[model samples]
Target: MTSLLEGLEFEHCDAAAARSIRDTVEDIYRRSYVQAIASGDPFDSPSEFMRRFDSYTDPRNRGFAYVIARVDGKPAGQIWGWSLPENARWWTGLNLDIGDDLEEFTAEDGTRTFGLSEIMVCTEYAGRGVARALHDELLGSRTELRATLLVEADNERAYQRYRAWGWHRIGWLRPGWPDAPKFDVLIRDLDLAVNEK
Candidate 1:
C-alpha cells in the first residue's frame, strides 16, 4: 500500500531485489547502533550478526521474509519476520524484533501472532509516519494474524510513537546485548476485528 504522505511505496524483497534489501537493512542497523550511543548508552551488535542476518535472502532461509519501504524513490525503511509455532520459548528470540516463538500469546479465537522483529526508518525520515508505514505493511501483509516490535525502555520518542499506534508492553529486556538498557516489548493484536478490518 502507498502512503498518502507524498511519494512513498512499500515493497517486499524478492531474490532479484535482495541487494537493495540488504543495503537498507545494514544501514538500518548501523543507524540504530549510532542512535543508542548518542543517547549516552551503548548497544551491542551480535558477534558475526551481520553475516547471519544477511542470509534472509538465501533460498535455504525458509520461513523468513523481508520488505523495504521506499520514500521519494529511495529505500527509507525495512521490516522482516518469521513464523512461530507452539511449544517454543518466548517465540521471538531476545534479538531486536526477532520472534520465532509467537505462541506465547494466543487469542481466544486461535489466530497466531508474532513480532515486527526489525523496523528501521532512515534517520532522515525520523518522526515521519515512515516507521508506522513500514510496520503497518509488515503486519498488514503477514500470514499470521497478530504482531509487534521491541522498543528500548528509555527511548521516550519511540515509546510514545508505539503507544500512539496502540501497542502495549508484553515483556521485558533480557541481558546480553552490550550496553542495552532493559527494554519493553510492545505488541499489537491484529486479530481485533475493528483493527483488522
Candidate 2:
C-alpha cells in the first residue's frame, strides 16, 4: 500500500472461467516478461503460457484461484494458484534431501496446501507496492494452511524478499518443461503474522 498503489483495484475471478479477463492478464504478463519472451524461449511463448493457464483453470482443478490488479483502469499485475492434491506431482521433481520428512510437506485431503503458480507486476510498476498489494489481496482471505512458490535460483532479489517475508527455502526442483530451470522452492505458512494482516 503505497501512494502509487492507492488507485489500484483488485478483482477475484473464477479460475475455471477466466477468459473474460485473459486479455488483460496476458497483457500484463507480456509486458512484465518481455525480456524472457524476447529470448526465443519456447516456454515463454504466448501460446505456451496460455496452454498452462488453460490446464490450471480447469473446473476439475481443486482450490483454484485467480486475482487481478488494475491500476489506472489497466491490468498491472496478477496472481494465481491452486491447492495441491494428495497425489500432486509437485514433489516428484524435487531435488532436495529431505528424506522421510518429505511426507511432511505433501498435501492430502483437507490439508489446504496451495501451490502459488505465478505472481508478477508490470516492470513499469515494480517497487511501487503493486505486487505486494496483489499478493496480500489474494492470500488474505485464503483458508489454506500453507502455500508454496518457486523462485529462480539466480533471482537473488526475489529470493531475499520471499525470505524476508517469512518464507523458508525447503528445497529445489527442476520441472519437466521446455527450457525449465532449477528453482528454489519456498514455503510460507498461512498463519504467518505478516500474511494475517
Candidate 3:
C-alpha cells in the first residue's frame, strides 16, 4: 500500500488559489462522495457541497488552507480548513452538554480554533495513505491550539479513521442546513511546537 502512493504529489493553496481551482475541487468532491450522492441525499448533492466549499474558501475566513493530492498528475484527494472567528456559531447545535468552558473555547480569538471543513479521497485511493497525507500536510504546521470537525454519525469508516488519527468525540451537532444529518463533533489538540520547528 505504501508503494502504491509513491507518485502522490501534494499542493497547498490559499483562498485565491482555491477559487481558481473551484471546478477541479468540486469534481474531486463529487467523485469522493459518489456513493452518498447516489443515495439521493440532498446534503450530498454537488450544489450543496459547493455551497459549503464557497464558505470555507471565502476570503473572510481567516487562516484558510486547502491541500490537494495527486497521483500520476491526476487529482486524488483534497483537504481544507479555516480558523473559526470569536464567538463562532460552530457549536450552536450541540446535542450534548460538554460544559461551559469547552463551549467558550472559541470565544477569545479567531485563531484559537481551526475548523477542518472537508477531507476526501477518491474511492480508488481509499485504503492508501492519500487522505492521511493530505490531512497531515494541511494541519501539521497549524498554529491553532486545537482543531475540530464534524463527521456523519453513521460513517463508521471515517469515524474510526478519525479516532485513529487522535480525535475524540466531544458532542453531536445537526447543522442548521435543511435536512442535515446529525454529525459527531470531534476535537483534537494541535501541538504548536510543530509550527515552532
Candidate 4:
C-alpha cells in the first residue's frame, strides 16, 4: 500500500518563474474547476481565468509567491498570493457589519497584508491533502501581519474548510466583474497563527 502524500513534491516560484509556467498552472486550474466551467459562466472560462492570472503575475504585485504540488512528477495543485499595496482597492466593495473599521483593518503599505489570489487542486488530487500542502508552503514564510482571501459565499464546503484552517469571514465582496457573485472575505492573522502554533 502506498500513501498518496509519499510521492508528493512541492515547487516554489517567484513572479517571473510563475509567468514562465503559466500554461501548467492554467492546466491545473482548468482541471480543478471543470464543473464550474461546465456551468457556462464566462467568469469561470479559461480565458477569463487567464486574465486574472496575468494580473497576479504582474511585477507590480510585489512579494508574489506561488507554490505547486506534484505527485509522482505530475502537477497536482497550486496556491499563490502577494503583498497588497497601500492604495490597493481590494476592500472597495466589501460590505462589513463586524463593528471594526474596515479601513484600519485593511491598511496596507505593501507589507501589512498578503492578498491570496488563487488555490486549486485537480479533481483527481482532491482530498489527498495537496491543496493544504501548497497552502502551507506558500504562506508559511510570509512576513506580512495577516493574509486575506475570497471564497464564493455559497461554497459551503470550501468556506467550512477555510474556517477550520483558521480563516474567519469578515465581510462579503462582489467583484467588479459583470455577473460576479458575492464572496466572503476571509482573513487570518499570521502573527497570531505563529504564536498559537
TM-scores, each model vs. reference:
0.69, 0.91, 0.91, 0.93
Give the TM-score ranking, best first. Answer: 4, 3, 2, 1
Candidate 3, superposed: residue stretches over 4 Å from native: 100-103, 192-197
The candidate that achieves the highest lDDT relative to the unseen native structure: 4
Q: Model 3 shows how many backbone clashes?
A: 0
RMSD of 3: 2.4
List, residue by residue over 1-197, the lDDT tens digit for candidate 1. 23435678877764346545565567666665555535543344533335546544556434455777777777777777655434423333444345544343432232365645567777777767787776667667666666656677877887887787778877775534444356787777775413633
lDDT of 1: 0.60
Q: What would the TM-score be for candidate 1 when compared with the true structure?
A: 0.69
Q: Any runs in candidate 4 off by more than 4 Å, and if so which?
A: 192-197
- Please report the candidate that would top TM-score against the real structure: 4
C-alpha lDDT of residue 143 in model 4: 95
RMSD of 4: 1.8
Runs with alpha carbons beyond 4 Å of true place in candidate 1: 1-4, 14-20, 31-33, 37-52, 55-61, 89-111, 175-181, 192-197
The clash count of every prediction, one per candidate, is 5, 0, 0, 0
